[model samples]
Target: MNYALFIARKIYNGGDNTQKVSKPAINIATIGVAIGLAVMIISVCVVLGFKHSIRDKIVGFGSHITVANFLTLQSSEQYPIVINDSLTKELKTIPGVKHIQRYAYTQGILKTNSDFLGVVLKGVGPDFDSTFIHNNMVEGVIPRFSDTENQQNIVISKTIADKLKLKVGQRLFAYFINKQNVRTRKFTIAGIYSTNMKQFDAQVCFTDLYTAKKLNGWEADQYSGAEILVNDFLQLDPISYDVLSKVKNKVDHYGETYSSENIIEQNPQIFSWLDLMDMNVWIILALMIAVAGVTMISGLLIIILERTQMIGILKALGSRNKQIRHIFLWFATFIIGRGLIIGNIIGFGIIFLQKWTGLIKLDPQTYYVSTVPVEINISLIVALNLATLLICVLVLIAPSYLISHIHPAKSMHYE
Candidate 1:
């Protein structure tokens, strides 16, 4: 008979005594392992969700790299916002340069009869990339500047619409200062959109480049500034640095500061809050694993003690010490492996249920995009399983040591 198989079979049935003291501890061990595996899988999926979601949203609004002049929107004086065809061609050749755009923005008020809404008005030239924004738009078009040529067509947001009781083709008065520094004419609301972002949905509006220039009384060729988009977002810092090398005197508007005065730099509280939560998740995982390891260790120890006679019997029958160790290890391995499989299935099922049904709810204002997002990284799952299996198998070493100490004559007669 294969001792490993026989020992495993014995252990599986050994915990059947209902009133036995050892049975409770063995039960706790299984529960601990199940809980640990579940927690690890869920934690990994959630964190991965957060990292990917935030990164996509940010990089969507602002490209990987941004370039601008020292003075911004209202303060900047006498500049060329347009990327001359020559500069555009040269910039396109730069590595990681996916698309380049010239964009201008101004803060203005939208008056609808009795109500007035303060909004940041953005204008983009024909070369502007709308792919990202267009795909994310929940309603309305990106506004075609081709036919009207700045003829009072603007896109407003849903929040602004609700506040102002405005809609497409309804004229909403937008007032701003012209280049001549005089109060400008009001623009007409031609279309409306919602980007699913509260901050932008409520306070931002858009039109084409010619429209902003016409309202500002500037030359047909002028603009406020340009926005550069990159191929990949990971190289954001490096690309920002390289572009700034050419325009050393220029200040970036989108994500402009390398200084402590910058909003992100000054108010680190947001990122700190996320990092703290991340730490908590990690700590929770570590504690769960420790709980599992301790409980499993206890169970193994109990098995080793109860089977002292059997280990000695196997040895007296000319069995190798290593074989005696394997006898118990086979049992432990089967137990842990079964728990791992079941735990993963249960955890993944819960995640899928929550994802499909949205059984879990969160405040949209706090979580940004609403609903809990989940991301599954297959590689991460594989790595976690491998680590757990290795660590648990190594831990069996301590329990297996019991075999060498079991002398045949002494253990067989002791009981």
Candidate 2:
């Protein structure tokens, strides 16, 4: 009993040959919409993927938040702090805290027969979360690193491994200079991992906390800092503030003041660059929507003009302008709906293919990822389709007004 929709469907089916002239225009409009939507979807997925991939890698290297001494923040040398059982228990009780692990850093040079490379030896205890490094392991396995035992085993990055011509199970000598005194230790490479992030891969290696602590001449109860993992990244800022308030004024046994910082604060340059990608995506979405709207307007105008005589007969039979406008809007909806279906198919197909096969590759040095990344968010895709259909119909409303201006008698003779 919906007369407007009924008439729109009849016109769309083109029972008569009169609609033939508008067929090509309609097809072009649908293609325009399809292409525009596909581009928008791909852009959104790729950008979101890039942001998440880079963010996770950075967090993997350190953690969501770090609580360290004030001196450690100012210099590479980690001033000792006491992260004893009492302090660990207090931090774990915080609402968002997931895990707390002890860590220390000491700088040294690994020497082989012909080459030497400087690296920061990251010391981790038995509680160290090796999930990230394990996933990225190219060869060998993570050793049992303990605070009480010195296994003399270390994990090196593929970048470092390649540069020093080193392999797992190879024994090498490392020299550490403390207050103008040179100390030497022999270590066996237990694992090799690669994150493809140059900053970490080139300069960081992992060892047992006891080894790192001994190099820094620290006691068993003292460490460089505590890395805190949170349940949700969205709560990082508030959790960091809560942690700072808890420990900021508290002095360690070594008389060191604690400072807390989140991953974003620790590496502002990389995060700022990621934030700028959002503006680029916004600009692309605007341009695509505009292109789709313009094409739909042109198609609507052509359909209206071609049906001039029908409009005249309907108006002569007492049809209102508003009713006539609804008919064309319904018709436009059909075209948009068809285009959206095709667009979704094409867009999702490309995304799945890329995600599974990683057919497209990028330079890790520049992009921080070896393959093009894509994220498929169902809610976002649905919103995009609904918004596209609504905007295209709204843009056609102005052109639909041309129907009211045409005199019935004149339009009947328009042919």
Candidate 3:
């Protein structure tokens, strides 16, 4: 083992007899590996970052899951339901439940002197976790509902504020229409936020739950729905089913029955699009690995040809075939490791630069985000490197077998 390792070191360091001619092929293989790995790292980080960004925005607009009256189906958000203490407690007991907040909404239009835009007046109680949306706030602060009275403050999106020429602390009239009459209320702009989720941003504004209930003529205990948050979003499907099973056929105070809807189900198209990115990422990974592997194979064959006389000398000295193979395999391992180090440095440097500087820009109207996003998952990075190393080592196996077939007498005499 020590002799084999010594031979590997000499070959890897270009200190062996074949060093001068094999150097270029080895360098080419290393460069190929570096480029392939860098592409893979960027692809994974960007795809996961995009998925996380979009999913968080959707969940921020509507939590991971919703429990509401059966009438508050996926297509519409107009129905009303009252929260039952027992049902809420039961939901809290369910595994993975992170937060439960009361929400109410009614259709309304915000009017300015020259322009008016329609929006859904979404109201949240004190239980709402403002942290998710707070990060996306471009101006002002998220409002906390007061228990003493109905808060007249509302949070509107930048899109809404821009269209209506509204600003923080500005007052506007929002008119809610019902079957019998249209009720109008004056509201103060508490904050402005931008998720760049055009559809939700254009149609929704945040306010106190009491205000939404009052606008809809609902009683003190009533809400349109309860937004449910969970700890692990990837576990959302099973959690949604668990929530549905627990809340299904359950009745609210006004004899309304309840059901649960998860964010993925409610926004299928967005999630489906996100899923498609997985296939894209896999294809990229496969192609890159193939390129790197092919390059390494070519480099290995070149190294073998250049060192044919060395192999004959080693075999003539009674060195076994397996030992000769280990030398080349170890050499290949060093090349791959070097490439990984360089690739990681360059790839992570680019990722960090983009993260801090926002160098890459995207169209918010199309992608729901303004800048290219990236996430550095350490486990993923480690796995990628390990898998690449393993695959490259395995691919180098067949090529190394050429050592065993080399005859000492013929190779040594072949010019």
Tens-place lDDT per residue, model 1, 1-415, is 9866785666676643422325565676677777788888888887777656655555555455544444442242423344456655765677777887766666678887789888877777667666766766555566665312765667787788889998776776777754466565466776666545576678877777776666555555455645667767666556665666655543333333221111222225554765676787778777867777777788788877877776677788898888878877777776677667877887798778866887777675667656777788789877877777667767878878877888999987755
For each candidate in turn, the TM-score is 0.80, 0.97, 0.96
Candidate 3 similarity to native, TM-score? 0.96
Among all windows of ten consecutive residues in candidate 1, which has the lowest summed lDDT? 257-266
Indicate the residue-level lDDT of 376 in model 1.
84
- Tell me the lDDT of model 2 at 331: 90
Model 1 TM-score relative to the real fold: 0.80
Best by lDDT: 2
Deviation from native of the Cα of residue 164 in model 2, angstroms: 0.7
lDDT of 2 by residue, 235-298 (tens): 9989999898889878976788888788999999999999999999999989999999999999
Q: Estimate, for each residue in 1-415, the C-alpha lDDT of model 3 and write its tens digit.
A: 4888898898777686543546689899999999999999999999999999999998988899999888877457577887857768989998999999888888999999999999998888788888877998999998897423677999999999999999999999988889889898999999999989999999889998888888888887888888999999878888999999988898866898888899988889999999999999999999999999999999999988888888899999999999999889888999999999998988898999999999999999999989999998999999999999999999999999999889999998765
The CA lDDT of each predicted structure is 0.67, 0.91, 0.89
Off by over 4 Å in 3: 17-21
RMSD of 1: 4.9
